[model samples]
Target: MKIVSLRVNGAGQAFIARPGTTLLLALREQLGLTGAKRGCAQGACGSCTVLLDGQPVVSCLVPAVTVDGAEIATIEGLADGQVLSDVQQAFLDGFATQCGFCTPGMIMSAEALLDRNPDPTRDEVNEAISGNVCRCTGYEPIVSAVLDAAARRRSRAGEGAKL
Candidate 1:
C-alpha cells in the first residue's frame, strides 16, 4: 500500500491506495465517499464520474496513483450545510432522480457543463449527461432538470448582480 494525497471536495485528503487502485475504489472504500459509484469498472459507465480539476472523468477508470494532488469533486460537495446547489435542487425539485444509481455522475456532468456554460441548450445538456445511464428516469427528467438548473443558477446570479 502506498499513500497518495488528493484534494477531494475542496479539502486535502490522503489515503492508502493499493497497487493499481482505481480512484473510485479509493473514494468509496478509503475516503468514505460513496457518491461515485462502481458500475462497469470500465469507462463505459459514467456512474463513477467525478470532477477532476473541474472536468468530468470516469473515476473507476482513473488510477489513483495517476491523480495524486488532483482536485476531485463528488456529489458530496454539491450542497452546503443546508442549502443545496442549483443542480442538486433542480434534480430534487424536478424529480429527475429515480433509482439514483446514476445521480451523482449525472450531477457532476451537469455541474461541469454549467460551470463552463451557465446557459446550456437542450442538446448541450443532453451531450453533457450522455455518458450517464439511468434506466429508471428515461432521461427526460434529467435533461429538464439540467435546463432548470441553468435557469435557476442564472436567476441566482442575477439576484447577486442586483445586490
Candidate 2:
C-alpha cells in the first residue's frame, strides 16, 4: 500500500491506498465520508461525483494514485457547522431529493455550476446537472432546486454589493 495525499474538503488528508484504488473507495472506506455513493462503478452514473481541482468528476472512475496531492471536494465539505450550503438548502427546501442516492452528486454538480455562474438560467442549470441521473423525482424538482440555488447564491452576493 502507498500513501496518497489530497486536499479534501479544504483540509489536508492522507490515506493508504492499494494500486488501482478508486477515489470513491478511498473517500467512503478509508476516510469514512459516505456522501458520495458508489452507484455504477463505471462513469455512466454520477453518484460518485466530486470536485477535483474545482471541476466535477466521477470519483468512482478516478484512481487514487492519479489524483494524489489534488484538491477534492465532497458533499461533506458543503456545510458550515450545522448550516448547509445554498444548493443543499435548496434541495431540502425544494423537495428535490427523493431516495437521496443521487443527492450528493447532484448537489456537488450544482455547486460547481453555481461557483462559475451564480446567475445561471434554467437551461444552464439543466446542462450542469445533465451528468447526474435521478431514478426518482423525475428531475423537475432537481432542476428547480438548482435554479433556486443560483438565485440564492446571487441574492447572497447582492447583499455584499450593498456594503
Candidate 3:
C-alpha cells in the first residue's frame, strides 16, 4: 500500500491506496466522495471525470499513487454552501441534466473547459464534453448549458473588473 496525498475539493486529503487502486476508487471508497460515478473503468466513459490540477481526466484510469500531491476537484467542490457555481446553475436552469448519472462528470468537464476558456464557442463546448457520454439528455442542452455557464462567468468577471 502506498500513501497518496492530495488536495480534494480544496481540502487536504491523504489515504492508503492499495496496489492498482484507481483515483476513482480512492475518491469513492476511501474519501467517501461518491459524486464521481463508477461507470466504465476502462476510461472510455467520462462518468468518473475529475479535475487534476485544473485539467479534466478520467479518474477510473488514473492510478491514485501516480497523482500524489495533485490538486483534485470533483463535482462536490463546485458549490459554496447553498450557492451553486455558474456551471452548476447553468445546468440546472438549462435543463441539461437527465437521469443524473452523468451530471457530475459532465459538470466537471464543463468546469475545466470554462476555467481554461472563459469564452468558448459551441463547437468548443462540444469538443470539451465529447468524452462524456450522456444517454438521457442529448448534447444540445448540455452544450447550451456550458455556453451559458461561460457567459455567466464572463459576466461575473466583468462585474469584478468594474469594481
Top of the candidates by TM-score: 3
Clashing pairs in 3: none
lDDT of 2 by residue, 28-71 (tens): 99999999998899998799999999999999999888888899
Expressed as tens digits, the lDDT of each residue in 1-163 for candidate 3 is 9899889999999999899999999999999999999888998879999999999999999998898999999999889999999999999999999899999999999999998899999999999999999998888999999999999999999999999
Instruction: List ranges where model 2 is wrong by over 4 Å.
Output: none
lDDT against the true structure, per candidate, is 0.93, 0.93, 0.94
- Global fold similarity of model 3 (TM-score): 0.98
Model 3 residue 22 distance off true place after TM-score fit, in angstroms: 0.2
Residue pairs with backbone atoms closer than 3 Å in model 2 (clashes): none
TM-score, predicted candidate 2 vs. hidden true structure:
0.97
RMSD to truth, every model: 0.9, 0.8, 0.6
Q: State TM-scores per candidate.
A: 0.97, 0.97, 0.98
Relative to the unseen true structure, what is the C-alpha lDDT of residue 112 in candidate 3, on a scale of 0 to 100?
A: 93
